[model samples]
Target: MTTPVLNTVLVRCSHTYQDELTVGDTKLLLDTTFRPEWHRKISAEVVAVPRKLNTRHTAYRGLKLGEIKAGDTIYFHYFGLTKENRLDTEDQDLYAIPYHEIFCKVREGVISALNGWALVEPVEVKSGSAWIGTDSEKISTQEGILRFIGHPKTDQPALNVQAGDRVVFSKNADFINTIEDKDYFIMQQEDLLATQPQKANEIESDYAGPRHYYETSPFYLSPDHD
Candidate 1:
């Protein structure tokens, strides 16, 4: 008698019984969480492809199996499929990284830098200084990098930086703080404030305007005249 050939396929899946998972356990937990939804949208044959980490993936709004593809690998603790503020955290409802870091392998997918801080390019300071005087006061046009103090809506407490204050850019200190051949806004050392540790709970409102949950806040007209 002839024996029949058997086809063996290893399907990957994972999930959590608890609220959060240790980073070390994530890989082992993946295969168990794989669901029918994984191949509902895309052909099931594509799941065999190997995926790299720290890259982008297709982000869907819900857990609909019909929307996912075979090659797609889910990176838990990241952005939600379609929702604006939902992310992979203890509180799925709480807002985190607004920009989604999509997997580059997936078609029609875009990726984000996934950085917390924004870049403030160099600005031109008048006469290599920020201050002049009333009659002789020099004006600075849009020439230098403006440090991203904070979001106007989320920072309600008010943190202020004057024209002549120096700030150390977290990402690029030497390039940002020093003067180059081109005119830039390098505040004199005397005018700069020493860096102070900000409390996590404390919102930076001075530079940015006010702190309000973007989804819940109402629209308001500009109170100040131009």
Candidate 2:
């Protein structure tokens, strides 16, 4: 019998924030501002595809089955620009090379580049699925992912996302697990806070009322002006 090709693949995304912030003040802030009804409306625009049944046969085997195809964009939500004071002694051995040694090598200019090997303190991982195909393709057993963050509501235009445009989202977290090898969570487009061009802008523009605001102040402002 031929191996059944599953419609969805598992992905591992790094945790974006520290545990202290997520559980303490950060979570509180998100709980206060997040409006479920508004987010649901945003998610409705993106068509949901039927997910294949979770079975032993469908579990992630390797890269051929895991490679992200065109139209699919993995939304990585992790803590950015925060100090991690927690001492992670238990998972020290999980590193192939000691953290100190890697730091030394990098400082000495011995290692020029570090990709996934570089560790983020208090790292949390999550995964989700998005179907890029239309009704016909969804019905068929096609394999692919779409690369676009949905357009935000009129009030949230600071998200500044245009349809078919790739974006990076940033926001604080609630609670994140420190034990899971890979943290996985199914995410919808509505969960996004702010978005900017995934890649560098090809064209330059001087007008900057609020095309893409990174600060929380600008984020809360009305997008109607710009």
Candidate 3:
């Protein structure tokens, strides 16, 4: 019998032959044989966010429909696009939207997005546990990317984090470049400094900037005065 692995986070790997598959004999084969069956297994819901407009700040209209369950992992595939091959000028500019902001649905481990971006099931971590176990032999980091070492104990409340929280960590550039199949990393809770909160209002009201700037900026107001 095959041994069952618990707490394994699975991410759908990005594909490479997107352009080739869309044209010539490959396209003919896929249309007749593969496309019909593939469409049956997957469904896609397009998000209605604005593309290009004359504005300095990008406005996020948000995902109006669909939902991602607790155990969903987001997969991002970045392809720097230009007008010569695929994207138009306006379409290319729309790509500036961050990957995390884009949302989609994947059902039963089947990916729905043919554009190479999809969300996989998230890995559930047990409550009160700081360390995430990984199957890798070593951890690596790229230059200019910050990596933190988490405290073994939770004595410091600063590093305390909840399970299923999205975290930002510095990744090993060399290792990532060398290994095409590897996914996920092991890290202590303390090593991570920031977590993406579920809501904007959940952010704490602490200021770490200069007092003068905090007092003068129009965005900031003193709570004590009010």
Clashes of 3: 6
lDDT of 2 at 115: 13
**Candidate 1 per-residue lDDT over residues 1-226, each given as its tens digit:** 1111111111132322222223433422222234423212111112322221222323322111222234433222222222442234443432222122211112234211111222233422333334222111242222223333322112122336522233433222222211121212222222223443432332222222112232134642233414
Model 1, 73: alpha-carbon shift in Å?
Answer: 22
- Please, what are the lDDT tens digits per residue for candidate 2 over residues 1-226? 1112343322211332222213222342233124322111100000111133233332221112222222232222222111231124442211111111111012221211111111111111122343222122232321111122222222233333443343332222211211122211112334443433433322212212211122356445343444
RMSD of each: 20.9, 19.3, 22.1
- Ten contiguous residues minimizing lDDT sum, candidate 3: 173-182
Which stretches of candidate 3 lie above 4 Å from their native place?
Answer: 1-151, 154-158, 172-183, 198-226
Which residue runs does candidate 2 get wrong by more than 4 Å? 1-5, 13-28, 36-66, 69-73, 76-226
Q: Write down the lDDT that model 2 would get.
A: 0.23
Ranking by lDDT: 3, 1, 2
Candidate 1's error at 15, in angstroms? Answer: 44
Q: CA lDDT of 127 in candidate 1?
A: 39
